[model samples]
Target: MNNFRFLVDPVFSKRFGIAPFIGPKRFRPPALNINDLPDDLDTILISHNHMDHLDYPSVKQLNKRYGERLTWFCGRGTRQWFLDNHVKNVIELDWWEEYHFSKKEVNIAFCPAQHWSRRTAFDTNKSLWGGFAVWDTTHKFYFAGDTGYTHNISIFRQIGKKYGPFNLSAIPIGVYEPRYMMETQHVSPDEAVQIHIDVQSKKSIGIHWGTWALANEYFMEPPEKLSQAVKNNQLHPSSFIVVKHGEIVDLP
Candidate 1:
């Protein structure tokens, strides 16, 4: 399955900005470069419109190269970004909505994620923000795109009841230090572990960390914190994994 590629939130850049002082500068670069992408990429799942998630240049380049062969799925109101770029096959989905690809035998459902979206000041929260539940005959995976720990625990519980007990999940685990500022939008490591339980995932991996130091916490602190959180929650070492950049795992 080396040629089978599906990219999620692929941002390969030095900063999250469209113009000067628009967003924070990236502390590090993406592990995978856009040019390194496989020629026969299957699909692209975009979660939101943040510069880090919905990169304009990357999208433009991919569309220019792959065109209609690449299918783009994103949050409800995020369709315009790609349409404006002249992308041919863009699918926008609302929360709890499902899209089926019969040929690929895959189903993708948009799910609730407690977060906000904004690429510019006037467009704050104008677009939808959420996670995705992707499933096929053999695997069920949840991608909690970008979210915060909120009172809406039922959102995940509902996901668990509706489409979960997932085989694997990708949850955010960093850029959440100094809770006062980030509590409304980012989930901490402990909260990420809670999400794993909430979603009833058999195995999960910590993401949204290591690539960029966007918060006050030290760059190397997330993995250590994730380890402690798992231990404190009495979870097995393999239940929630911390993978190195560019590392490959053979999912069973």
Candidate 2:
């Protein structure tokens, strides 16, 4: 299986004149600056329509650079947007459709996430939103886009058991605040740990935190709380890691 490397929390363009920021005040976000990446990038799987995940500017840049050389997989609701933008080579899938690409046996499955979607005021949930499960013949990886704790997690666990024992998972662990309001949309650090256990992944990395200021909590809290939760729950430190921007992990 080819090892996948992710460029975490990158901001390609400033939005609404606000410079994109990562984490609290401590970390620096990475910038690739190029419109095109490697030619071997076969597929780009996006979790949802949120600006961060479905970044239009970045996508446009990539599309212009790579054209049909890259295939995009996104949530069902995002089809029209891509069509409007004239993005070909795009596949929009609902919560459980599987798409395969390449001779390497790479398969992608769209999974459900407990979150609402709206790029504008008139279009909430206009597109289905969710996470993703990617597997090659030998290993599986879960990318938990923005989500809250929900029964669907167990569904993913069942899916994992049926087809997995995933080698790695990228689960969200930030943006939860004022539990009353965020609980239904974002998972807390503790809840993230529970997800790690539910999926029974061999190792899980935390993301989506330390990226944007989407909530009221202090920025540094997510990683700190995640660390404590892992200790309180007795999960191995090596099993869960919080990566910085520009960092790369070679999948085992």
Candidate 3:
């Protein structure tokens, strides 16, 4: 937003994991390559340490090309991993922590999410996982990193009350199926709509689906359900939506 560019949970590999070819293969190739990104792109926001969300190869490549010119923001305990990879311009934010890029232009805040992290078998939750609330001169945005609808219901309200009525938000709407097992870790389409409401978002773009075959749900099912949920909730169709890969959303 404004003149700054930031990428969140960027996973551009053919597959989702520490190595591109190891995990769930993607149904579609990444929309663009690292080199295709705008020259002004100077920031990255990593919500957590899951291999899928924090692809090692992509991060390494980005840092190699931009070096210190790019600043990285991620949850606590992840800064060391970036430093170990030779990326020094990295900052770790705790829940509700805000980083002032420029008081007048940009401010990035890390907020809690109902999610867990496990890159390796041994380090489950050793690092933090959450979402981000970003504000530019004229717009506010939220990126709801891999999370489920929490039982408390008050979580989203708190987020909204604190830094919400987001001009735009990115909320996950897939990889949920066999509700018995996924409900605790991922939100169903209806739940996602509830989140949009609770967070007081003006508009939300669906994400975390339509790419890799990570769960058993039919890949196209998310948007279908999202549409129904929007109607059930009496929301404008465009209030929360999905964009095809490579499509751009022009916001006022």
Candidate 4:
């Protein structure tokens, strides 16, 4: 992302949902809390309006710390939520739309993802949901916030053709079990590996796992399955890796 700093889908709360403790419980704590994040972050990217990814407590803390100086980029129909919460620096984008920073050196594009959005009983699909394709003059990156592996397969190939060969990328690789119910919304580790190739990511990391006990899979199952998928595909293990929670990884 060039020299720009960004945070995506930040959640510091231990419980997620409409109420304090009425939702899924976080099994592991974040590597760094809102107070411990790097001081230089000027942007936040939210893929959708899911309570887990768009934690209210974290948003308030971020807005208070950065105010209008920090910009919030989210999917369509999501800006109103931030505005209602007094966050005035928020911007929303539709799928395939690109937003350029004031510097004109950085670009953020919202890409279509096979996922649904809902924060309440009546708001299902009211807001847009998707992944991000971001880049600067020197680096290209993709963040697959949360998506399932579509049988069509070409959707991801389309992403690679449009904006890919990413220097580094982050793709979801967990919360996928009991394929009967989860297959359409979350990708298994094996499918995640295919997405790595379909998106042409040079180096990718597994995310959205080992944090909350939202799915039926074991906490340690994701990385283990992902490792096997990498080998099954004959790709280098480092090409797609799962790091310890709170681990700092360097990107080329």
Q: Which scores higher on TM-score, 2 or 3?
A: 3
Residue 9 alpha-carbon offset, candidate 1, angstroms = 0.9
For all predicted structures, in order, the TM-scores are 0.93, 0.88, 0.97, 0.96
For residues 1-252, could you state the per-residue lDDT of candidate 3 as single tens digits? 877789999887788665555778889888899999887786899999987799888888998789888899999988988898888999999999999996237999999998898888888998889999999767899999988888766577789999988999999999999888888778999999998999999999999998878788999999999999999999999999999989999986
Q: Which candidate model has the greater TM-score, 2 or 4?
A: 4
Residue pairs clashing in model 1 are none
Clash list (residue pairs), candidate 4: none
Model 2 earns a TM-score of 0.88
How would you encode candidate 2's per-residue C-alpha lDDT over 1-252 as one tens digit per residue?
474433322346544121345223323443356444565666777777767667666777777877887677888978788889878988889888887765456888888878878877789889988878888877788887888888544665765675567798888888899899999988999998888887778899988776566788988789898999999989888888888766777765
Give me candidate 4's TM-score against the actual structure. 0.96
- Cα lDDT over the full model 4: 0.89
Candidate 1: where is the Cα deviation over 4 Å? 1-4, 19-25
The deviation in Å at residue 78 for candidate 1 is 0.9
Displacement of residue 177 (Cα, Å) in model 1 is 1.6
